[model samples]
Target chain A: MPLTKRIIPCLDVKDGKVVKGTAFVNLRDMGDPVALAARYAAQGADELLFLDITATIQERKIFLSLIKSVARQVNIPFTVGGGISSEADAYNLLSAGADKISVNSAAVKEPALVSKLAKRFGSQCVVLAADAGMQADGNWQVYVNGGRKNTGISVLCWIEQAVQMGAGEILLTSINNDGGRKGFALSLLQEVTARVQVPVIASGGAGSLQHFADVFEQTGADAALAAGIFHEESITIPQVKQYLYKQKIPVRL
Target chain B: MKLVIVDYSAGNTCSVIFALNRLGIAPVISADAAEIRAADKVILPGVGAAGSAMLSLQQNGLDNVLRSLQQPMLGICLGMQLLCTASDEDDASCLDILGGQVQKLDAPKIPHIGWNDVYDLRGDLFKGLPENSYLYFVHSYGVPVSRATIATAAYGQSFSAAVQKDNFYGVQFHPEKSGDNGLLILKNFLNL
Candidate 1:
C-alpha cells in the first residue's frame, strides 16, 4: 500500500545493441536493446535505464532512434544517459520519448547545465548520474568521461550541489563496485540519500538478490540498478522482486 | 472511436501516442480546439511544472476549450493537477474543473518517483484491474483525496490516484508508461 522500492535493470547499449562488461570495460554483446527492454518490462522491472556506453555525436542519431523504438514497444518509464551535454540534447531525447535524461560528465563540466535542464524541462526530467570511486583516504572522488577521468571533487559535495541545482533524481554509481558485482556501495548511498531530498537510485555492484534487499533495507535508496547479472540470466527481475518482497521490502510484483 | 491526445507541449505525448498505438488506436495529437472537440474522447497528458503548463494552456486558449468540453477528457500527471482549482507548486490557479487543491507531497522524497499501488478503485477507469494494482508514478504535487476521487494511492499520505466528475477524469499517474495495467486504464477511458 506504500511506495515500493524499485528494481531497475540497466542496459549498457553500444552501436544500438546491448553490451555488458566489467567495470565499464571488456564489452560483449548481450542482445538487442529494444528486445531486452521489452523482456525486462514483462518481467515486472520497476524501471529500465539505457546508458549509451559509447555515446558519441555521430551515435546521437542512433541513440535517438533506439529510444523511439523502445518507447514504441516498452510500456514502463525509462531513463537514458550518456553524451547529453546541452539543453537541446536533453530535449531531443525527451521528445523521442525518454522519460528522463541523465547527465554525468556533462554536469561535471558545467554545473549550471543541471539547473538549465531542470528549469527548462522541470527537475523530474533531469537525473544526475554521479559516478565515483572510493579513494585510499575513504572519501569518494567523482569520476567523469565514462569513469575514465577523475574530477578530484568529493562525491558527497557534488551530489548535494547538483540537487540544489534542481536535479530531481540521483543515480549514484560506484565505479569500483560497477561490473564487479560484489555489492552496492551501501555507505555512499546511505550518505547521499540522507543528504538529498530527491529520490536516490543506487547503481553498480548488484550481484545477488540480497544485494537488492540490502541497499533498500540498509539505506534510503529508492531503486537499485543492475546490468550484467540480468543480462546473463543469472538473476531475473521477478526473482529479485520476489526476494525483496519476502525480505519485507515493498516491491511491485 | 476518434480520440485526440491534447498536445500542450508539457507532457510525454509520444509515450501516450505509442500506448494507444499498441491498443490499435492511433490517436491524433493536437493542440487545435476544433480537432480536440471533434474527437469522441480527449486525453490531456502533462508533465513538468504547473505554472508554465497552465500558461501554455491559457496562451493557446486550451484552458477554455478543456473547461468547456462536453465529451470525456482524461488528464494525466500534471494534466490532472491542472484540472484542480489551484496548485501549491507555483501558487498557480488551475482550470478548476475538479474541486480541490494540488499540494506538494509530504513525503521524505520530493518528487515521489517510481511505482506504487492504487487502492480503493472505483468507476470504470480501473475496470478489470485488480485492487491495489501497481502503477508507475513520478510526481511531487497531488490532489488530496476528495469526493470526486475514484481511486487512491499513498506516498507519505493518501492522495487522489484517479478522480472523475461527470465527463472530466484525471489520473495522477502516467498510465501510458504504466505497462499493462496502465494500458488497460487507457482502454477503459477509451470505452467510456
Candidate 2:
C-alpha cells in the first residue's frame, strides 16, 4: 500500500476572526481562530489552513498572533494564507509556526514570485491558491480578493503555469461551489486535476462526508478542503473518514 | 517520564503534545538540546514545505540534535518526509535521516481527503486499529513506499502510510486527529 494525501478544513480569518459566507461575505465571527483550530484538531481535522483574508490589501500582518497561539495549542499541520503578497509575509507565517504559506492573488499577479520563493525557500514552502469562478464561456477563470477580482486567466492554465513556476501545491477553491455545500463542481475539479501535476486541494461545496468521498474518489485530487461544515460541526473529520473507509477509499487511520 | 516533542518552528508540535495528554501520556514540548537529550522519547511533528522546514531545523541547530538522538523518535507527516533523503515537494533535500525520496502524489483527484483505510499494518501501532482503520491525512506529497513502510493505503495509487526503521518511526497521517483508532495508534507509539 502507498501513502494517501490529506483532508483539510480551512478557516478564513478577517481582522482577527474566523468568518465564512457565500462568495466570501456575510462575515460573522465564529470563534477565536486558535480555539476553533484546536477544536477541529480534536475532532480529527487532518490539518488546518488559516487565511488572513484582509491582510494583503491593508498590508497588515496576516494574523500572526492567531497563528502563534494556534501553533502553541494544536498538534496538526497548519497552512496560513490571505494577504500573503511577499516572501517576508511567508517568512513571518513560518516564524509564527505555519507549516506552509498559501498564495493566490499574489501568484496570479506575479507568476515569477512563486518561483522566486520556491527557489529561495523551496516549492513545498509556497502553495498557490486559486479562487476559481466559472466564466460565462465555460472556462474556470481565476478570481482574487475574496472572489471580487477576475484575473482573466483560465484556472487550469494558471495551475499548470504555477507548477511550472515551482509552486509545490495548489489550493483550488471554487467560488461557484464555495459555501454552497452542494458538493464540489466535479467538472471543474476533474479538469484541474487532469492538467496539474502537483497536489490539488479541492475547496468549496462540501456538505457531507460523502461529499468528500465523492470528490476524492471521483476527481483524484490530493486532498479535499472544507470550512463551513467542519467549523459548525455539521460533520466531523473522523465521521467523514470512517465513511470513506467504508467506501474503501484509502484514508490513513 | 513525559513524552518530549521537539519544537523547531514546525507547527504541529503542540497538537501532538495535546494528543499525547489525551491518550493519558503527558508530553513536554521542547526545542532545547538538553531537554531532548534527557527525554524518554521524542516525536517530531511538522507541516509545510520541506526545504524551509529543514532550514528552521538547521537554524536552531536541531538538525544535528535530532540525528544524534538514541531515544525512540516518531516523525509525523512532513516530519516523516524530512527524515527521508529527498522529497519532490520543493525538490527538498531532506534530513536524509531515512532512505528513499518523498514523491509527489500526482493523481486525477488530489488532496485525497476523507478517512481512508491503511493496510499491511506491521507493528503495535495497529493493535486496536481495525483492519483498514481510518487515520487523518493532509499532505500534498509523500515518501515513496519503501522497505520502511509498515502499512499502506490507496487513493489514486497506494503509497507509504506508516514507516519504521530502527529507532525512527513515522506516519504520514495525523494520529492525533484520527479519533479512537488514531489514538490507539498513538498509544502504541507511546508504548514503543
Binned by DockQ into CAPRI classes (incorrect, acceptable, medium, high), candidate 2 is incorrect
lDDT of 1 by residue, A1-253 (tens): 7888888899988998999888888999999999999999999998899998876777878989999999999999999998889998888989999999999999999999999999888898899999989999899999999899989999999999999999999999999999888899999999998899999999999998889988998999999999999999999898998898898889888
Total clashes in model 2, counting residue pairs 3 or more apart in sequence or in different chains: 33
DockQ of each: 0.83, 0.20
Model 1 error, position A120 (Å): 1.4
Question: Which ranges of candidate 1 are over 4 A from the true structure?
Answer: none
Report model 2's TM-score to 2 decimal places. Answer: 0.73
lDDT by residue for model 2 over B1-192, one digit each (tens)?
Answer: 667888876643555665677677878777899999888888888865787788888888888898888888989888888889888776878888788988877655445544567888888767767666766676768777888999888767788889988888889887765666777888888787
- Model 1 chain A lDDT-worst window of ten: A52-61
Candidate 2 residue-wise lDDT, A21-79, digit = tens: 77688877777788888788777676788888775444355377778787667766678
**Proportion of true inter-chain contacts also present in candidate 1:** 0.82
